[model samples]
Target: MLEIELLGVKMKNPTMLAAGVMGSTAASLNWVSCSGAGAVVTKSFSKMPNKGYKNPTTVEVTGGIINAIGLSSPGVETFKKELESINEEVPKIASIYGASPEEFSQVAGEIEQIVDLIELNISCPHAMSGCGAAIGQDPQLTFDVVEAVKKSVSVPILVKLTPNVTDLPEIALNAQKAGCDGLTLINSLGPGMKIDLETGRPILSNRFGGMSGPAIKPIAIRCVFETYAVADVPLIGVGGISNYHDVVEFLYAGASAVQIGTAIMNHGPEIFAQICQGLEKFMEEHGFQSVNEMVGLAHQF
Candidate 1:
């Protein structure tokens, strides 16, 4: 009942394992797929290896956890090895980032053959150098990167955007014009931080990082709802989804599919099955025959 075809890639259900959560290796990606996630996104990688921030990368906050892992990656060449090892039936998406359009294109081109989709992670709040939100926050940069990647790869591309932007719809429209097949909204929030009362210091080594959990859902929904109103490309909703109910809300807010991340920290890969089961039951009781039927329901009003 939850089957969805996103940018020509078919999925058994709408749930996807968001990038950055148990997505650093083939084993974990396979595990999430086995646990019932329809698709999985690998951790964001770059053309060159990045060690990212030091210890104390994540900390618990009032609403959710804040993390500044610095987008550490083992580089594209090494990540390709892990990607080739995934043995799951579900579609695999490679989440990539770079400091420039050429770099982004290079990474996407190399891995296009190994994955069904490429997610341009231009919204990581804590990315080091010039890689993350710096690209996403500018409409021109978003277009340049998306256009470059589109020219380099045949696989469908989704630009994961930052909610930290002031003109999100403008950025979303630019990506569409640049030929992105779809969009992933609201890649965490803040660059928020937590302070240790006893130590009188920041908990995370980076001082601040992106926030993810139940608290960011409303903003995520708003971003999706707003972006849907302006862009024609499909959207993959993310940020703080923990239950089937959250998935339904995203659909109604205009998401073609939903991705689960922070919730995985609390529920493990099993969250996929639990959410799928709950989604199926919810669909049955609500008379919704397919996930498509629920997309953008709120826009009508």
Candidate 2:
């Protein structure tokens, strides 16, 4: 009952593995697939290798954990091998990042034929200085990146946006105008930090990082709702989703699908099957025959 189609790619359910969780390798992606995720997105990679932040890159906080993984990637050439190894039955999305539109286009062109979709990582709050939320926060750069990727690849392009922006709808609209096939709302919420009281030092090596987990769900839902009001393309919601109810909330908020990230850290891959089974039951109880029927239902009022 929860099958969905987005950016022309078919999903058996509206659940996908969000980038930067357990998405770095073929084995993990396949594991998520076997566990019942309809699709899996790779950890964000770049055209060139990035060493990322040093030790203590992640820290636990009250709501969720903070991470400044610095968009660490092995680069596209090496990442291609990992992509080719994923099971064909499960659609694979390669999440890639670059500093400029040309660089983004070049990377997208390289992997277009190998993956079902390409997620432009314009929203990583802890990414390197020139990349990440900095570029996505600007509508013009968001437009340029989307336009460049659209020009470079035949595969569907999804622009992941940051919620840290003052005007998210404006950026979403710009992406649509530039021809993005879909949108992924609210990549980790803050460049937030935790400090050690005794040492008077920041907990993370990078000093600050993006927050994820259940704490960000409300903001994610709001971003999805607001973007749905203005965007012409489908929306993929990712943030603090932990169960079937969270999935239903995202769908009700207008997400065509929802991506699971930090939750996997606590629940393991088994969470995928658990959530899918629960979602199927919920759909039956709610009298929804398909996921499409549930999309944007809350907005009807």
Candidate 3:
């Protein structure tokens, strides 16, 4: 009942393992797929290696954790091995980032054949100085990257947008205009931080980072809702999804599918199976004949 397809890639269900969580390696991604995830998206990698932030990369807050992982990656050449190793049953999506349209195209070229799709990671909140949200927040650059990648790879391209923008639909529309296959909403909420009460200092190594968990769900839902209103492409929702109910909410809010990240940090890979079971029951109970039937229901409200 929950089966759906994103950009021609078949998903057993609507649940996907969100990027940046248990997505860095073949083993972790395979575990998630084996646990029942419809698909797996690898952690965002770039053209070059990145060590990411320091020891205090993550710190918990009231609703979620603040992180400054710095988009650490093994670079495209090395990451190809891991992508090639992913199990056949799972549809693999390679999430990649770069400082420029040229770099993004280069990285996409390197891994396009190994994975099913390419998710443009121009929305990392704590990415290094030049190559992170800066690219996403700009309309022209977002188009350039999307257009460049579209030209470079035969694999479907999805542009992940940042919620930090004042005008998200504008960027979403621009991406579609550039010929992107689909969209992924809200990378993470904020560059929020948790301060050390005793030391009166920020806890994270980079001082602040994107917020994830229950706290960001509403914002993510809103992004998908607004984007779906004007976008010609489909959307993959991410942020703060912890339960089957959260997935339902995203579907109601117009997401074609949803991704779970922070929830995995707390629930482990088994959460995928548990949520799928719950989602199956939910669709039956609510008379949702198909996942497509549920998308954008909130607009009717």
Candidate 4:
């Protein structure tokens, strides 16, 4: 009941291990796949290695954690080692970021052999200059990046978008026009921040970072819902998914698949099976035969 095809890649289920969490190593990615996740996405990597931010890149917030990890990566060449190590039984996705179209295309080409799909990380709120949300915030820039990467790679491309935008549907339309195969809706929300009481200073080194967890799920759902109305490609929903019920909401919001990150941090890899099992029961009791049947069900009402 959970089987679904994404951009020609078949997955055992609709649940994926969201990038940036336990995605840095082949062992972790392999472990996640073994733990019941249908697929796994690596942490976003760049053409060249990046040290990212130093000490205290993450801090706990009310509904989630604010993170400014800066997309730390060992570069594509080095990341290939980890990619080669992933179990071939499960589909793998490589999340990549760059400052320009040339750079984005280069990285996508280099990693194309190692992953099933490439996800452009254009929506990181606290990325360094010239990268991340800066590119995604501009529709033209988003089109350029996606177009360049598409020209350079035969592999499917999924552009991860930012919720920190005025009109997300417009941006989604641009990506689809650029020939992108799929869309991953709503990267972390806000350059949200927190101040340390005793120190009288901002907690994160970057001062502000993306807000994630339960607080951003609503925004994610809205993004998926609106984009699905105009999008020609399948959508992947991500944000604050914590349980089977949350997964149901995302599917109802028009997500073909959903990625889990913070929930894994809060629980463990086992969350995949737990949610999948619960989802099976929900589907059976609801008289749904396939997960695809549940996609965008909310639109009926």
Model 3, 43-111: lDDT tens per residue? Answer: 999999989888799888888888889999999888999998999989999999998999999999988
TM-score of 1: 0.99
Worst 10 residues of 2 by lDDT: 126-135
Q: Model 4, residue 148: displacement in angstroms?
A: 0.5
Per-candidate TM-score against the hidden true structure: 0.99, 0.98, 0.98, 0.99
* All-Cα superposition RMSD per candidate: 0.8, 0.9, 0.9, 0.8
Tens-digit lDDT track of model 2 for 136-212: 98999999999988987889999999999999999999999999999998799988999999999999999989999
User: Candidate 1: lDDT of 180?
Assistant: 97
**Candidate 1 Cα outliers beyond 4 Å, as residue runs:** none
Candidate 3, residue 235: lDDT: 92
Per-residue lDDT for 143-250 in model 4, tens only? Answer: 999999999999999999999899999999999999999999888999999999999999999999999999888889999999988898999999999999999999
Report the Cα lDDT for candidate 4. 0.93
Candidate 3 segments whose C-alpha is farther than 4 A from its true place = none
Show the colliding residue pairs in model 4: none
| Candidate 2 regions with alpha-carbon error over 4 angstroms | none
